[model samples]
Target: MPYDLPDDLAKLSLLDIAEAVAARRLPPVDQWHPGEVIDSKMRISADGTWYHEGSPIRRSAMIRAFSSLLMHDAADSRYYLVTPQCRQHIDVEDAPFLAVQMEHKDSALAFRLNTDEFVIAGPENPLRAEGDPDCPAIYLAVRHGCEARLNRSTWLELAHWALDRSDDLSVTSMGAHFSLQPK
Candidate 1:
């Protein structure tokens, strides 16, 4: 559960960590798939920052600002924005906007809510999350339309975008609302 533990406490809670992790991740298979974890966390820091515990890992961010949906076309859709305190070193193939992902989960569309009106700014003089150098607010939108794809496309997009290319099969999920993305 404690993904970002301070090093000093590691020795004090070794056994507690093991039990805590399993208790957090396992069970409920008959009702939920092993991969289908529910909303686990939403934390706000003292410095106007926050962290959401995501499946692949935790996402740490500063509450910059967010975007609103401006386009009517579903294909273009909305974008959720965030500013990671550190430069996220990801696979070269996963760096571009066109290939970024969206996890298939409850309230998967939550990211797109702020759409085009989000950003995170500072704690010090000239305070800004990213300083003078700019980084594009990451876009969380649909690749295509609703009809062409099934109800699970949004999270499926995230799974596919985990790699350099998209998935071969179109259908997915246990019982989540899905969407479409451009081919």
Candidate 2:
């Protein structure tokens, strides 16, 4: 079945958006514990491009399918395409995903990832800033210990939105306050 994303996010309330995000049927990658480990020869670049054996994977559907199986193992600090039988390691330059778009729905900030996945920023999925002060990178926590770096345009939009709410370079969503300043 095709994933149905809202045509107009602004028209949806925070509860509606939350329900939509929670309704996505994702694979149980977190529960999969495969003893076999091998290199998948796949790389997710900092720019959110997926490459296999040094060639870009241009198929969006393939990317989305693989992304659903992606998981990060905090014990080894590695990412893998996990299945019931094996785990294939993959290289990630920075973040595995990129936040290509953002919207302010009700009292929360909603983000659309490069793979066309939706994530809402809140206590469970917080927004953080890192890197140098001059060129800070904003990241939002995605599931399975993964994060998505906000693209330049999305970051700018978020900054503008935050500034409109306050002057301290901070934003509040779902009663949680987030500092956009680089740590």
TM-scores of all models? 0.17, 0.94
- lDDT, candidate 2, equals 0.90
Name the lDDT value of residue 66 in candidate 1. Answer: 14
On residues 1-183, what C-alpha lDDT tens digit does candidate 1 reach at each position? Answer: 433322222132334333432343322212321332222243323222234452222232122121110111223332122122211111111111221112323212222111111111111101101112132112232221111011134334443543333353222233332222222
Predicted structure with the largest TM-score when compared to the true one: 2
- Per-model CA lDDT versus the true structure: 0.24, 0.90
TM-score for predicted model 1 compared with the true structure: 0.17
Candidate 1, position 162, lDDT: 33
Q: Runs in model 1 with CA error above 4 Å?
A: 1-101, 104-183
Model 2 residue 113 CA deviation (Å) reads 0.6
How does model 1 fare in lDDT? 0.24
lDDT of 2 at 47: 93
Q: Model 2, 1-183: lDDT tens per residue?
A: 775545566566778778878888899999888889999999999899999999999988899999999988999999999999999999999999999888897788998889877899999999999988778899999999999999999999999998998998898887789999997
